[model samples]
Target: MFEVLPHLAPDPILGLSAAYREDTNPNKIDLGVGVYKDEQGNTPILSSVAKAQKMLLETETSKTYITPQGNQGFIDGMLSLLLGKSSPVLLSDRVAAVQAPGGCGALRILSELLVRCNDNAKVWVSDPTWANHIPLIGSAGLKIEKYPYFDKATASIRFDAMMETLRQVEKGDVVLLHGCCHNPTGADLTNAQWDEVLEVAKEREFLPFIDVAYLGFGEGLDEDAYGLRLLIENLPEVIVAASCSKNFGLYRERVGLAAIITEDSKTRNIAQAQIQSIARGIYSMPPSYGGALVDIILADEALNNEWVSEVNDMRERMKTLRAMLVKNLHENGSPKDFSFVNDQKGMFSFLCITPEQVREVREKHSVYFVDSSRVNIAGINQQNVETLAKALVSVL
Candidate 1:
């Protein structure tokens, strides 16, 4: 019976990691994965997290399972941190949150809830969103539609085309929006464009499903969440899948949360109950470590400040790398203008290289990037930037 089980396709990003591992080339550079690496080429644990772990070790605590809804304080702190207390949704008692395994877990559970609730509901995602978005949501038996987003010509967001596509959306449609630092394509909507999106959502009565994986990496904590905050102000029911992987560097710990915004406490409670049920059928409960670490950091004033500053440092460092790459690429006699890369945000940038060029970089230059040219800018550290730049020049 087990043998009858069909073969499975490998995850694109994960597969890349596996392939990179087996490669014989010693000089191969891997920019395929989304993990952050410092200038020394290390994904170090932040000092704030170290302190949190130390405090946890000293304190007497039970290893018993946390609640299905997760640590109450984590939920509260995460909600407040992601969406401030004074935000319209929270102020109206319209928000409900539950801890999930990770952003992927949150997305899966949310997809199950939405599709199970209404099979007719359509989820619209950007044409070139995170590749996993399709399989995760589709596994819930819901079909996804594509909205115009990336404009290769300008290497920027086609806001006009995006708005036009969304204008036709009706009430009850689930539009999966990246909160900040859009994956695959670093191009994102501006604050003014977010306002326009909210206006359209309001007019069309569409529900907003926000995925915020790279919150602090884009602009800053409060700044990255600006679009999400605006959505809550306009929409009554919004679904959010927030990830601690990028911001807190907790990818391996699998930390994330799913939230819903509704009109009243009664509805919020009902939605929360459903979320818990869904979580139980899935992972039963989230891992305690990452969530606990985040909770400890957020709850402590000094530690929170330290974590914020560290994140800011990481953001700035990525910005510096982007500027350097753009500058160096332009000066290297390459005809292609890579200046657009500087204007992009977050850790990942679409190098705009074709599949052929991508393959050439990997084979000849030993530079690894996704076929779509989505490369993690963080992977190019100080030691390897020039090497990567020269390799990129060779490929281009």
Candidate 2:
């Protein structure tokens, strides 16, 4: 059996990360991974998380397994964070939430839940969605399809095409949407565009499955959640997968939430039972540390304020970095205009360069980017922005 197994290629992003680590170039820049990095080229833990950990360390007493749904405080806090504190859904007690290992786990668990709901459940994702989505959802035995999303030519959302494709989605099918800070292409839908998508979703009668991994990275918390809230408000049913990896700097801790909004309280309770049963079959229970930390931070007044401030700082830094890169590219006399980078939100954007050009930049300039030319805006710093700009210009 072992001898019959075939070799597999490494994941593209991880492969790029390994290559970057091994490169001897002193000025090498890594823009491959999706994690947030500060000006010092480090993924710093938020001060609020540090404080929360200290508090937990000092006062916490138990190491036993948590409930199948994990910490209730964490579930409530995440619900408030995703929806508003006074959201009608929460007040009506129509939402069911469960903690998962991380965003990916939340997605997979939710996908499995969909399978339980409908044997032939099909999930439609963006054409250029995060690569892991394919395996994470598909491995659970759900059929996957793609709809047009980002257009490289204009460096913007292909809204019309996306809407047209989604129009064909049949009832009971699930559509996976990035809640905010769209991965890979950072281009987000405007409020008007979101309204259009909502109209289509309503007409199609398909369930909306939203993945919200980078909530605070796009804009303010509420601003970033606008589209998600819109769908939840209008639709009788919605599914949300949220992560604390980016906002809480809990990457290693692997904290995430899977929420289901149902048509009524009875349905919500049933969904909760089903989701808890699914969690029991998957990881048994989510790790307690990360969820506990998030609960502590959200429950405390000062720490909550501090965490929001820290998230704002990170968002502003990414915005500044986007502007800085575009400025550098213009000053370097690049034949192309990167002004669209400034208009986009969050940690990533496409350079819109070819795969060959991507390889050339990596081989010749020691600047690493994924094949699609998506770069993490957080990877650029004041020290290396000019160098990166020059390298990009040379490749062009």
Candidate 3:
């Protein structure tokens, strides 16, 4: 059995990270991982989280397992955070939510739910979605299909083509959508475009399974959730996978939520039971520390406001970095136009460079980004923007 096991290639992103760490170059840059860093190249813990942790330490009593659905405060807070307080869907008695280990866990649990609902369940994903989505959902024995999303020529969303393809989805099929700050490409749908997609989902009679890992990264919290809320308002059913890793800076804590909306209260209760049962079969129970921290933060008005402020600051920093990179590229006289970089939201943007160029930049210029030319915008700063721009110009 041991001899029959085959060797596997290292993950591309992790492989690049290892290579970057081994290189002794003084000026080496790393933009391969999809993590948010500050100007000092640190993933700082939010002040809100710190305060909440202190509070939990002082008052918390039990270390035993919470419910299979996890903390009620956390689940309620997440629903309000994602769908807003006044959302009509909340009052309709059609929604249910449960905590997962993280966004990936949420997605996997939802995939199991889909299979339980229909044996031949299929989910449509974007062409250039997060790399892990394929494995996380597919490994659970769900059929996967791709719809045209990113247009490489312009490095933007291929909205028309995407809509046309989605139109072909059969009734009751599941469609996976990025709620905000689309990963890998960072190109998000406008409100108008979201309206179009909503229309298509309605007409096609398919359910929307939204992945919202970077909710507050695109814009404000409310602004980023506009499309998702719009869908919840109009449609009778939808699925949401939300993560606290990026926004709350709780990456290591593995905090996430899986929310589902159904046609009526009975269905909602049944769905909740199934989700809790599925989670029990997987991780048994989500870690209590992260959920407790999140619950405390959301329950306290002052801490919640501070968290919002911190999220806003991070969003603004990314925007500024985008502008700095674009300005540096233009001033450096690069042949390629990178103004689109500023338009893209979130922490990532694909450089649209050849694989050869990417390798050349990494090996020759001490610049490290993914082989696909995707860079983390947060990895750039005032000190290194010029150097990165020059390195990119050399490759071009």
Candidate 4:
């Protein structure tokens, strides 16, 4: 059986990281991994998180397993964060949430629940969604389909094409949407476009499964959640998988929440039990550290404010980096119009360069990123932006 197993290729993103680490070039720039990096090229822990960890260390009394739902404070805090405190869904008692290992874990658990609920349901994903989405959702015995999403040539969302395909979706199918900060492509739907998609969902009766990974990375917290909140308020049933990795800077802690909103309290209770059952069969229990950290930050008014401020700083830095990259590109004599990068929100954006160009830059200039040319904007800084621009220009 061991001999019969086939060798597998490493993940593209992780492979890129390995190659980057091995490169002897001192000026080599890494725009491959999705992790947030500060000006000093570090994924620093937020100060609020540090404070929370200190508090937890001093106060935590036991090492026993938490409930299947993980931390109740985390669940309540995250639900309130995702949906407004006064959201109708909350007021009506129609949402069920459970903790998961990470965003990946949340996605898998939610996908499993979808299969358990309706095995035949097809899940429609964006054409250029996060690479992990395919295996995470498809492995749960659901057929995966693609709808038009990003247009690499234009470096923008293919809204009309996306709407056209979604309109054809059958009733009871699941449509996976990036809540904000779309992965790989970085392009996202406008509010008007979201409304259009909502109308289509209403007409077709398809279930909406939202992936909220970069909650505060794109825009303000509430602003980033606009489309997701709209669906929850309007639709009778919705699914959400949220992460604390980006927002709380707890990547290794693997904190995430999988939530489902039903029509009423009765259905919500039933769905909650089903989700907990699915979690028990998969991971048995979720980790407590990350969730506890998030709970601490959100529960304390002073710490919550501090966390929000830190998130705002990160967001502004990325925005500044995007602008600087475009400026440097222009200065480097590349005739390409990369102005779209400034308009796109989040840490990622496709450079819209060909695969050959991507390879040439990597080989000749030691500028590392995935073959798709999706770069982590946070990787750009005052020090290496010019080098990156020069590399890109040389390839072009």
Candidate 5:
């Protein structure tokens, strides 16, 4: 029976990480994975998260099994953070939330929910989305299609092409959008662009399913959530999958929320139950410690403020790195203009290099990035910025 299992290919990013670890090159640089790293190349836990954990240790006593939906406090806090407390979605009793393992888990459960609602529900994803999205959504038995998003020629969002494709969306189809800090390509839609998408969505009658994994990593807390908030405000139905991994630095803790907004309170209650049932069938319950930490931090005004500031600092640092890289590339005598790096927000940017160039960078220069030439801006530092820039030029 075991022999019937097929051999699986190693994950591209993780395989690159392993290769980097084995290389003895002194000047090797890794820009593959999407995790945040400090100037010293460390993924440090946030101070706010530490403080919240201490408080939980001192006061919290119950470790018993939580409900299928997990902690109500965690869900409520996440909902408030994603959509303001007084937003129409919340005020009208048309929204509900449930704690999930992480954004991936939330997305998976949401896929299940969509399939449950309508077995033939079709989901439209952006081209060049996160690599894992293919398997995650497909595994849930939903049909997946692509829409034009990033343009290699311009190194920016293909808004015109995107609108053209979305305009043809069949009614009742689901359109998956990146809430902020679009993975693999940091190009985000401006408010005016978002307005246009919303109009198209309204006209097409498709539901918006937003994955807000990098809420505070783009511009700011509320600022990064602009598209999502706008959707909930103007639309009667929406689905959101939010993660605390990047913003709260709780990657391993697996804390996230899955929220749904319906047209009425009765539908909200029914949807909430369906979500809970889906989660029960999947993982039964999400982890408790991370949820407790987030609940404590979000409940306290002081801690919440500090966390927001820390998130802002991280965001600013990535922006600075983007600028520094562009400068470094220019100083290194590159023939092509690479200023688009600065225009992109969040932790990633695509170099738009061919796979052969990517291999050259890795094999000859000891520099590692994905096959798609996507680099993590957070992985760059003042110490190695010039080196990375020079390596990129060498490959060119």
Candidate 6:
């Protein structure tokens, strides 16, 4: 029976990572996976996370299992991060939140819940979303629809088409929105576009399922969460699946949270209970270490400040790389205008390269971006931006 099991495709992003490991080239550049790397191309554990971990190791007294919803403090901290400190959305404690394994786990659990509640409910994701989103949501049994998002010709968001598509979505459908730094394609809705989207969502009566993975990696912590917060404030209820993998640099730790806005504490109590019930069977409870560290840092003023500063530093570095890369690519004399890269925010920029070019990049030059042409902006440093730009020009 085990031998007869069907073979499967590895996750495109994570799978490319294995191929990256096998490549042998001194100049090999890996801009495929969404992991963050500093100027030296090293993924470092943040000093704040390290410090919080040490404190947890010293003060945490039990091997006891955490609640099914994990640490409430962490959930609260995540809320404050997404919704500002003075947000009225938290009025009378009307939000329901749960700690999940990671962004993927939260998404999977939400898919299951969506199926459980409404089998016919459709989940509309942006065109060319995170590769895992398709399988992750589809496998849970629901209608998966693609909303018009990226415009290949312009190498940016087709907001007009997107808004038109979203306007037609039926009531009760789940509309997936990338809160910030949209995965795969970095093209996100502008502030005015967000207002238009919310208007459509309100009129159409569709739920906003926000995916916020690269918070600090985009504009800034608070800046990145602008859309989600605005939705929560203006809408009656909203859902969010947030990942600490990028901002907290806790990828292996797998810490994430799912939040649902509600009408009141009574409504929140009902929703919160359901979320825990769903989590009980999925993973029972989120891991203690990462969540606790997040809680500790958010609880402490000094540590939280340091973490914010470090996150800001990472954000600025990615922006600098984007500026430098776009400058070189424009100078590369390619027919394609690379100015779109500078406009894209967050860890990735969708290069819109074909599979053949992707192969040429991997074999001829050691530069590796995803087959869909999504490159991790964090992987670009001062030393390699020109090299990557030249490689891209050569292929073009």
Using all chains and alpha carbons, the TM-scores for the candidates as numbered come to: 0.97, 0.99, 0.98, 0.99, 0.98, 0.97
Q: Please give the lDDT score for candidate 6.
A: 0.88
Which residue pairs collide, candidate 2? none
Per-residue CA lDDT of model 5 for 178-273, tens digit only, reads 999898899899999999989998999999999999998888888888999998899989999988888888999999899999989999999989
Question: Which residue pairs overlap in candidate 1's backbone?
Answer: none
Error of model 1, residue 369, in angstroms = 1.0
Error of 6 at 358 (Å): 1.7
Ten-residue stretch with the least lDDT total in model 1: 85-94
Worst 10-residue stretch by lDDT in candidate 5?
84-93
Question: What tens-digit string does per-residue lDDT give for candidate 1 at 1-396?
Answer: 799999997887878888788888877788989998888778999999999989988883789999998877778889988997666566777777888889999999899889767988999999889999999899998889999999776688888888999999878889999999999898878999999999999999998999999999988999999999999877778899999998898889998999998878999889988999998887788888889889999999999999999999999999999988887787776678998988899988898878898889888877878889999998877677777888888878
Q: Which stretches of candidate 3 lie over 4 Å from their true place?
A: none
Candidate 4 residue pairs in backbone clash = none
lDDT measured at residue 96 in model 5 versus the true structure, 0 to 100: 74
As a TM-score, model 5 comes out at: 0.98
Q: What is each predicted model's overall lDDT from 0 to 1? A: 0.88, 0.93, 0.91, 0.93, 0.91, 0.88
Show model 1 residue runs off by greater than 4 Å: none
lDDT of 4 by residue, 1-396 (tens): 699999999988889999999999999999999999998899999999999999999999999999998999999999999998888788888889998899999999999999988999999999988999998999999999999998988888888899899999999999999999999888888898889888999999999999999999898899999999999999999999999999889999999999999988998999999989998898788999999999999999999999999999999999999999999999999979899999888889999999999999999999999899899999999999999999999989
Pick by TM-score: 1 or 2, better one: 2
The residue-by-residue lDDT of candidate 3 on 1-396, one tens digit each, is 799999998888778889999999988888988788998899998999999999999999988879889999999899989999888888888998899999988999999999899868789999988888898999889999999999878988999899999999999799999999988888999999999989999999999999999988998999999999999999889999999999999999999999999989999999999999999888878898898999999889999999999999999999999999999999999999999998899989988888899999999988998887889999998888999999999989
Q: Model 6: runs farther than 4 Å from truth?
A: none
Point out where model 4 deviates above 4 Å.
Answer: none
